[model samples]
Target chain A: MEYVVQTTNLSKRFGKESAVIGLDMKIRKGEIYGFLGPNGAGKTTTIRMLLGLMKASSGTIQIFEKDLNKEKINILKRVGSLVENPSYYPHLTAYENLEALRKILGVPKTRIHEVLEIVRLTEVANKKVKGFSLGMKQRLGIAASLLNSPELLILDEPTNGLDPSGIIEIRNLIKQLPAETGMTILISSHLLTEIDQMATTVGIVTKGKMIYQDSIESLRMYAQQKVLLKVSDSEQAWRSLLGNGIKADWEDGIILLSEHSDGKVAKAIHTLVHEGYSIYRVEEEKRSLEDIFLQMTTREKVI
Target chain B: MIGKLLRADFLKIKRKGLWFLSFLGPFGVIALQMVNYGVRKDYLLNQSDDDWGYFLEYVHSFTPLALVLGIAILTSFMASIENETNAWKQLISLPVSKMSVYLSKFMVLGSLLFVSSLLLGVFSLGYGILLNLGDQIPYLELLKYSFYPYLAALPILALQLWIASVSQNQGIPITTGVLGVIFAYSAFILPDWMIWKWPSLMNEWDEPLINVMLGIGVGTLLYIVGMLDFTRRDVK
Candidate 1:
């Protein structure tokens, strides 16, 4: 139960707007922790705080068992980061960009070649980044982050601006990092689907608050999967479905039993059809990360 | 770590292509003298010792002005290079203290400009030597003449570095630096005895006695303040 990063009551304020409010987070060692929330939900702000890029308006941050504010240099020596868009000198070659970062981090030159290989940028390493596509630039950024062989890596929207294939490549790369190097990763994105495949644990935030945090498997079981019901008699069917100990919500005349399985839904549907209801539709709907994310945040926004 | 930072700073400074201005400054001084010497070639050769001395003094006077402008432009460009590259974010994230980060660039730009001014002084002195007037002109005396004014101009160099470090927009630092030089020039117009004040000392151009003490005090004050302001201020 060793946590690589822990933030207790961390909050940040920009004049009047509270970008992050009382955010308490825990990211265990060797785990890929996904931070999922909508735009402006404080995901980037939290990451900035953790990296010591921005100071917290209040609260404590601990990185690898060291107090972040007090031991920032020592803590940062073991952590690497890419927050927001990857910034580099457009005129510099990919190798030059990494070289500059290597110098600042005081990493050995050999590590530069190793990271370029890791990010699969060895072929284009000598090419100026100005001509590189967004995906190539992103890979170069990831390569720079890995130059120090850090114990923890924090990335904000790491796959952003990449094509589908590029996304898959980065996803696979992120998936392999922990297994191969024993690095803990904190990936923040507004898109849950992006993190669903890689992250071991997920923290779902809405309106700057952590609404849910759990293992990915538990989150899938308790929050994501839905028992979708397409029933006959679209009007009275809803009433009877609700009446017969079936708790369901309406969407385009399809009843949604959230976080439920097929057998539970089947029993409810059979009861409705047995009661002389003209059942036109009945099928179990598979919920996606997008669906879960939309449901959680939309509900929070409404409240 | 500081050495790494210095290398990165040098790479960035060299990439901006600003060293051309340093060459341009001394070259401009020689060019102007060449044109003037050509226009008055016959009259300048027939002049008396006092008149030749006046021409030599004019060359010496104009050289410092060109040198100051060079220092101002070079300083502004180097300090603002960080804003252009977004290098401040990356550089500041390093384990070093923020003061060293700001001062290192300041020192680099200051040293480059100081060297350029020294070169321009020698170049201007050589231009004077070429006039070939009938008087015994002391070559070593002329070199010492150029060095003296450079010492006095050291405070102006510190002032430019301060402006450059705190300003993000290149225009602001350059504008402030130009105006500062103008102010220093006006201060030097007063009698020499009345010129030991900070602004006046910036243009006091020949008293080694006054130059060394005021140069140390003013340069140290500006460097300390500039570093403090930079390290303490937030980077946008």
Candidate 2:
């Protein structure tokens, strides 16, 4: 019941278009809260408002029980964030960058070496950031954010522009923080697969409105199941199945049969095979976060 | 405490090498003047007290030019580095007060510019000594002259810092700084009524430290506005 972050009726507007609408959300302590959305879905905009980087057009934000605007310095002291690209002074060494951050935060010098070890940048700590790869910069950014051993860590697409192994490393690093130190994390990413592995709770926002917010278990339990069937001719199969009282959603030669029973699938397949409809594949489909997200967000588009 | 904030600000300045340029800038100017003196050695040597007066006059004239270049480059670049590296996003997110963050940067840049002017005064005295121009060498007098002229630069430094912090773009801050210097020079030609209290144009090199006090007043006002502007700004 102790929410680490809460935004009530939060909104942001640029000229006429509302980048983020009336969004109400809550994130509890010691949890990996995943914010999933498509590109241009206002994920970054909301993060910026929450971090006090930008003013909200309307409504309020509360972090760690402190009002964001009223207690900015207090809230920020307990919060660490990596927004957009990981940036640092390219001429300064990795250690130097961390040192600069530590000085700004008034943290002890010992914390610099501790964070460097945490990010696994000890060997290259003295090397200038100019020659560092994309992953190295991200790790350094992460190290800088952890300088104060913050209670809340907000990461916006931290795994973006990383190699496969780098992505896994960052993912594992994020997963370990909550258990190891009890730091509540808010991670935003466009890819559901990325959040699926780590997040304890997930919030799916599309076009600034939070459409779904629940734990992974609840999402899976409440999520609609569908049978996926791939046919030789998706358009023809859909047409044939429609005549037999079977509703099929066709996408790229695959018929996604939602809101349909297994008996309904059997009858449709029987009619398709007899009518010389080439059946390539048919399987009971497991609904991923992507499927649930698409169903939730794309429903409006269909209407 | 202000000391911790000042230390943090100074560390940033040291890391960025702003202090080095403060030393290097005035040194470069003295080197250029020495080279100029070398080319006209025969004309400069056979001179009386009146001639020494004329040479001293040239020292007075050239010192402001040196201060101009030093302050402009130092103020513009130092203020923009935080923006160029997106460092402010990380910096202001710390436990430090927003006002402290703004003041820290302004204080460090102001401190460096003052140090540069002090070096120029010492170098000018040395330039006179090396030339054997006895009357031209007003070592104690030159030291006295440096304070007010450096103070006169305070308002300009404050304004340039304001421009740099608000814009968050390298070219705009530096370009605005160069234009501000030009405006200051032009204002000097205007009548007393038309001439606003543009500190850089005051030229208090030979005047009392009173002008420096006045410059501090105007500069403090500009610095306050700059700090407020930063606190209200929306960071990208």
**For every candidate, what is the interface RMSD in angstroms?**
2.3, 2.1
TM-score of chain A of each: 0.82, 0.80
| Local accuracy of candidate 1 as per-residue lDDT tens digits, B1-236 | 66777777766664566777767776786687689788987776566555546665656656656656766887877766666556566556556667777767766776676666667666765666676554566665565545555555566676777777667777887887677556545555555432222322233464454765666666677678877877665454
Model 1 chain B: worst 10 consecutive residues (lDDT sum): B194-203
Counted clashes in each candidate structure? 3, 0
iRMSD value for model 1: 2.3
Candidate 2 C-alpha lDDT tens digits along B1-236? 45667776665555667878888866876787678788986776655445545555555555555666666788766765676678777676667777887888787887887788788777777776777776435556666556656776677777777887778567886776676556555655644221123343343353445556667787788788888988888777
DockQ of each: 0.36, 0.43
Cα RMSD (angstroms) for every candidate in the order listed: 5.3, 6.4
Docking class of 2: acceptable
lDDT of 2 by residue, A91-207 (tens): 778888787777667788999999999999999999989899999999999998888899999999999999999999999999999999999999999988898899999988988
CAPRI quality band, candidate 1: acceptable
